[model samples]
Target chain A: MAKKPELDDFRVPFFDDKGKPAKFSPGEFDPGAKPFSSGTKEGDRERLAVIGALLDGLQERLHAQRVRRVLLVLQGMDTSGKDGTIRAVFREVDPLGLRIVPFKAPTPVEAAHDFLWRVHAQAPAAGELTIFNRSHYEDVLVPAVLGDIDADECARRYRHIREFEALLADSGTTLIKCMLHISKDEQKKRLQARIDDPTKHWKFDVADLDARKLWDKYQNAYQDALAATSTDYAPWYVIPADSKTHRNLMIAELLLRAFEGLKLEFPPAKDSLKGLKIE
Target chain B: MAKKPELDDFRVPFFDDKGKPAKFSPGEFDPGAKPFSSGTKEGDRERLAVIGALLDGLQERLHAQRVRRVLLVLQGMDTSGKDGTIRAVFREVDPLGLRIVPFKAPTPVEAAHDFLWRVHAQAPAAGELTIFNRSHYEDVLVPAVLGDIDADECARRYRHIREFEALLADSGTTLIKCMLHISKDEQKKRLQARIDDPTKHWKFDVADLDARKLWDKYQNAYQDALAATSTDYAPWYVIPADSKTHRNLMIAELLLRAFEGLKLEFPPAKDSLKGLKIE
Candidate 1:
């Protein structure tokens, strides 16, 4: 029998200590692969539900302890499943403890400050779980692909991202980042489907299609950003996202492992309240 | 044939044009009433699912039109189901279109500013749906009930809230406020349940019982605040919340009616993109 698949196999290698540019390519992984699925849709969904329940309990314990934080960063292209992944994986968790921040185009105020300023303000506090939909990685990916920043400048931003993540890690936060990977062919189908339906027209803008024209550039930018920023304190995983069920399950499995690794426990019982009665 | 229970019947009478306060009291409503239920738990759930689906579509149109906003404010005493109502009513809506804000005891920085400052910063933008788990109403209820502010001061703060809500309404935002009403006996049972379970201890505070001792005062403060602030643009509804399903269903029904009244439509098709194909 083939060896059981491991999550680390998909992790971008840790950045080299010598400050050399690390090399990796998005094209090396097939988007259609389902390395973590249970071989059937029903089975995959059942597995996801199981993981969701465990996540709910773990999140409760995290909140009860009130001493640790968890941050999950999701980055993907337009047609990838960042929103779907958040809805599916967190369906069972209490909304009180889960904070979802969707970062869009920078406003004038945000653009005035250093790129990390707005992001730092939203860092998860103790006993909270935060999900960043399309995070600061966009800073590196967009400017580089548009030729607004040179290679050295992009590398410098990558280092800043690594250091910022390290700051969060040092402050009792566990960070997990994923780049949802999808094929160009899948992009064509999604865009075509939206265009064929008039109801979906609002989600489309003519300028939105301009990104597909620069697909290869964006992919290469992602490759450089992932290779340079993946570190010991914060790691990036490439999620194969062509199969929606498989994508949800793999991400769910990854998160459950990260949370369980925290070994979260509820705060100890209070001795003074052993026999306390409500008046 | 029996008459239907119009949601408007439970609405706090709109503030009079002369600004005379209404004389209604929270004690007039029964916590165990289910005026909106379909007479069985399963029936109420089915009704809720129907309303949830309609709400999902209305929210999509609200986002597409990008012209109007919806804000739902939920305030209740301990264990009266503010969090539960949000989780249930929004279970089917796309998370992309919804934002949930939970206000806790103000921090030093927040308390430094005027009460409405932090709240104004979170008002819903055009084409969005926002929910406040607890809201500005707390400023009146908690302070007045605790004797931290005199009745006259509480009334003055109520006027400030009315003005602030009018500002939002003038900017094309629709506001719906619900006060979850539960009996003191129900609250006692719920608090006792939390105390009995060690796992739920973190959610309990010794100071919580002190508030229970002042339940009648809180009820009176709620009565005064609701009568003073309810208006044509922003109305307050009393929700009988002892039955969780009934509370969820009734709120879902009320929200659907408010959303449908807006008559939202998707933006017109762009003639420039008529039949354009992506490269």
Candidate 2:
């Protein structure tokens, strides 16, 4: 029998500090695999809800303590279920404690500054749980895949990204990054469905098809980027996302495990309120 | 028999633009009133859920259109349930479509600028629904109640608020402001509960009791601020909040009504995607 799959099995291998980076291939992962599913769609959803409730309580404790920060970075190809994962995974989490930042194509002002400028401004503060829908990773991925940046420039951006994320981690930010891995055939189906349904046209752009044509190029770019930046402080996980329910379940489980590892608890009771009575 | 309660029944009489401002008194409204309640806590929660689902759909259409903006401002005394309202009312809305900005005491940088300077930066952008939990109103209420700002400066801030809101309204933003009104006795019980429960002590502060002692003064300040700043463009409503259920219900209903009035719908299907087939 095949060995049971673990969350670690999907993590991009750690970058070698001794000048020999580990090899990673996005094509090696099967997007249609259900490694983390609970067997049935209904069972997967039930498990997801259980994890969601756990996450919700943990988030409240995080806010009460007000000493830690969390950043979840989500990067995926078009229609690979990035938005759906957030809406599903965080359905039970308090919106008050959650901040979602979606980064689209850079505005003129944004492009004028260093790539990390806008992302740095959106980093999670103490006691915050922030999710970046699309993030600074785009700065490296888009330009590299489009041939606008040479290998040296792409490598430099990766080094900067690692250094910037280290600064955040040193200041007490826990980061989790995921790449929603999907197959090229699945993309064709999703894009075709959007085209068939007029109501969804507003979400569909012809430009997305142009990107789809460069599917192999994007996959290669992601493989390189993930290999370079998957560090101990900020690791990247490849999620098989052909099954939406399985994708949500895997991500929720991953996040829940990360938060539990933090062992967060409410702050100690205040001495000033020990014997006080409201008048 | 008394007349049926309408959401408008709670709105502060509009501030007259021509010379004479309207007369309004916060003390006149009963903080314990449940005019919008469903007569039972269970029923009220059900109604809130119904409105929540409706608001969720309306919010998606608003995002799809990407042409309009919505801002909800929540203000109240320390324990008036600003956080609770946000958590309960938006439980069903997509976190992607919602942004919650909690304005605590201004930082040194923020305080150095004019009062509205920080607020102007956070106004909702197009295709967004933003909520301000304890908003710019604090700038007016706090200084006035402490006697730090004289009558002239207080009046000037109100005018500035009016003009700022007018600018937002003219630019296609829909604004809804609510003041969660809790009575003194109810606040006493809530504070005592927090004090008695050591686990919740983190959320309590000794300074809250000091503010409670000046309850009447805060009421007067709120009354004056609401009266002077309540214009047709951005009106303020008093939400009876002694019962948490009724408070959530009323605010949800008010927002649903406001959103429905916009008649927001998904943008028309894309012409470029009309008959294209994905290959």
Instruction: Pick the DockQ winner.
Output: 2
Isolated chain B TM-score per model:
0.97, 0.98
- State the lDDT at A143 in candidate 2: 97
Q: Give candidate 2's error at residue A197 in angstroms.
A: 2.0
- What candidate 1 gets wrong by more than 4 Å, as runs, is A19-21
Best candidate according to TM-score: 2
Q: What is every candidate's alpha-carbon RMSD to the true fold?
A: 1.4, 1.2
Using lDDT, give the best candidate's number. Answer: 2
The sequence of per-residue lDDT tens digits that candidate 2 reaches over residues B111-147 is 9999999999999999899999988999999999999
Off by over 4 Å in 2: none
lDDT of 1 at A258: 93
Alpha-carbon shift of residue B95 in model 1 (angstroms): 2.1
The TM-score of candidate 2's chain A against the true chain A comes to 0.98
